[model samples]
Target: MEEKMIVLVAFDGSKAANEALSLAVKHAEAFKGKVVLVRSLKGGADIDSEDIQTAEQDLAYAEQFCRERSVPFETHLLVRGCSPGEDIVRFAEECRADEIIMGVRRRSRVSKMVFGSNARHVILEAHCPVVTVK
Candidate 1:
């Protein structure tokens, strides 16, 4: 039997992330693929239990959304004090994803260079094709 095509999406409950999630669902429908939702927390001394709880809620919402669309999906949380971009790319690689979908916000080139953009990093580092939704 053929292996299932996987579409990985980076989500954080922001508008852009939600947009990415929606697009991933559409893409999954088009390709008969499964969706994987990933949420990354920049681990730090400031991160508290409440933060993890909130992240879990966001993932739950994402799961419900996929279920409403009748799309098969799994959610993952990455919190190893790593950059979101790195975590996202690592998860995609581990899953052997066929494609990655992420949300990006407009940023000046200089600002992006100074304060790295996760979307940009994922685009550069992912092993598969990446789709960005603003």
Candidate 2:
């Protein structure tokens, strides 16, 4: 509580992601810290122009929310060629984040395995504590 908290939020424009953002903002506001919102894309064939546009829109929306709440924030659109989980984990370490906030969608075990759960990967790989929002 003595030091400013650096809260990293994984945002993807979903309801769950929005919930995570809200939580991050509350934490930052209470601690007089900062919030870092990150959206990850693998680029290339994995993502299209529409995806890029949506990411921008989502980032803008989150930015507006933070501005309205007077919460200090940063927005990062990461296009590194890796899984979202890896990007998030690496980014957190790079920024030396105090905590990570993200959302977990209910998925069948098979689906998670096929799609690769970013939350699971992040929980296992991140150096910082991760808080998940439904």
Candidate 3:
């Protein structure tokens, strides 16, 4: 029997994230694997009703996306006092994921030099293989 793969998809409600979601669904379907969609809320972000509602919407959209594709998946929202990249890596470890899929915004040299990339951080820290979608 083939090994059952656990895929962790990191979402931030960006177009790149949506692309990662799409790829994750395809991969999961092909491998007959299970997908865990995670949305992280960084610390210091406001937690008003509107913000909570927006987070719910993001998870809903991800769930809908997988449903439309007939992908077997689960959804989770991680709201801890950590950076997005850190949260993703930690969650993947906790879930014992075989792979992680996340969106990456291509940054210019100046931007990358000034501000570190979340995708880079996760890639460096994750124990599992990471797939970054632009």
Give the alpha carbon lDDT tens digit for every residue of 44-116 in model 1. 8989898899999999999999999999999998897889999999889999999999888898999989998
Question: Model 2, range 44-127, lDDT digits (tens) per residue?
Answer: 676799999999999999999999999999999999999899999999999989999999899998998898899999999999
Using TM-score as the measure, the top candidate is 2
Stretches of candidate 2 exceeding 4 Å from the true structure: 1-3
- Residue lDDT tens for model 3, 1-134: 77668889998788999999988888898899978999887746465667667877998999998888888889888889788889999999998999999999878999988987879889999999999998
The global Cα lDDT (0 to 1) of model 2 is 0.95
- Minimum summed lDDT over a 10-residue window in model 2 is located at 42-51
Candidate 3's displacement at residue 68, Å, is 2.0
Residue 49 in model 3: shift from native, Å? 3.8
Clash count for candidate 1 is: 0
Candidate 3 has its poorest 10 consecutive residues by lDDT at 43-52
Deviation (Å) of 32 in candidate 3: 0.4
For model 3 the TM-score comes to: 0.90
Q: How high is each candidate's TM-score?
A: 0.93, 0.94, 0.90
Highest lDDT scorer: 2
**Ranking of all candidate structures by their lDDT, best first:** 2, 1, 3
